[model samples]
Target: MTASSSAQTPGKKDALAGREDAYNGFLIDLEGLPSSPEALLASLRASEAVWRERAYRGIWLRLPKRLAGSTGAAVEAGFEFHHAEKEYLMLTRWMVEGQPDALPPNASHQVGIGACVVNEHGKILAVRELYGPLRGTGVWKLPTGLVHVGEDITETAEREVLEETGVRARFAGVLGVRQAHNVAFGKSDMFFLVALTPEPGQTELRPQLEELEGACWMDPAELTEQPHFVKRPLFQSMLRACRDWAEGRPAALHQRKITSDDEQRRDLILLRSTGGEDGEL
Candidate 1:
């Protein structure tokens, strides 16, 4: 039988089903960059079943096209690309470092995006970001920006906060790091959860039209039910931060789920109700 047909045959079905379970289990234990199937395979080399599947199929099992598109030789080639990439990383690591664990670090170098903490009172000294992918959007997000070369993360945070929010705030402590995979941008963003110590009163927030359309602070919980929440990881982190702050478990904060489509529509309404122009246009 052909390999495709064999996968559907009764005898092979049972083995493949078991393999599917094992594949998931292997993925859970892998640590390398999983942006691509080949990267995943290289990191999961200890599994013999996975290796055999790759050999029999002549490709990596986790090829994206195999999961998404029509079955064809090209689809199979997509799998092979991943397989070859995995093989290359494996051989290079084995020869150079003598073990996968000895391989060089690949921690992503991130462009710094600033962090801001809205207090228990639900006030955020935010920036009006005017020109970027998110420009002309009425959603007021926490003041954030990329770190220039030679700038420390904390220094970058402090600078961006003051520049964007118009408040001289002190660093409180780290909240946690948040990351999201952007398939459209072909990059992942790492958002640092930072605490900012600000003055007790409402500060005059300004809008740099070059960077923002508008800037202001509204209730954080209000956005939880809105659509703009989908665009702001800072807002999600704020919820966890508030929870931890309330519970006196500041260091125990965990990342929250990304906002859903339903929530986004609600936020759009909330922002528009404020006499703010529609953020989505």
Candidate 2:
């Protein structure tokens, strides 16, 4: 296998050369390399020495799918698997000692919420987006948006529905959870399925023209017949679950009781006795 290197300081031949984009260290791109464990071991050992001598912060070794066989070598050499996709596997090793055992505290997963709003007539609220990855695909989906800081998941669902369809609904409970890797801009995403019902007076549909082409209530039969919707079995399943919930079926509780700072400490003690600590009954 052949290996090539790039650095912030072009003329410098040191592998551990400092660089602004290297997270205070260097990066080794190992794409399109042959799957040879021996060659990978040799490269990793050499890189480790350079990192120690230069006192770099960290090093990232990116291995494409073709070189996936070399992953064992990387791990043995103290590189942790950061993330992976169908195209590549990313691994990183910190040169500094005493790093935390877990991922950096700042590492986070993107949280999103999808509102499954159904009316008393057994019709579900759906919207067509004016622009997105699935725009013009004729796919109608529930209103969804990212969860902002200090915002609850249920509140996010309600806000997204109001902003996209101009319909205010009450949160019922959680329907399900969906996790996808490398979904949005290479970040892992967690989507909560929140159930909602129309409030006493809010039944009118007013689509947000900037993001939605149209908003309407669709019957279950129509949803099943739609070609695009039929292609997505998960949407069909969620619709059925939401409909059941609207018809008085029970759902998992997603809401929690609010408590004062002093009460919060006591609540933690109670939770420990109720199997919350070990996640058992």
Candidate maximizing TM-score: 2
The candidate scoring highest on lDDT is 2
Taking the tens digit of each residue's C-alpha lDDT, what string does model 1 give over 10-125?
12211222122222121121122244544344433433344354433222233243223322332332322222232232111112123233323333446555465565565545
Report lDDT (Cα) of residue 139, candidate 2. Answer: 76
In model 2, the Cα lDDT at residue 273 comes to 24
Candidate 1 wrong stretches, greater than 4 Å: 1-107, 119-122, 181-187, 199-202, 230-238, 242-281
Q: lDDT of model 2 at residue 222? A: 71
TM-score against native, each model: 0.44, 0.57
lDDT of each: 0.46, 0.70
Q: Any runs in candidate 2 off by more than 4 Å, and if so which?
A: 1-105, 260-281
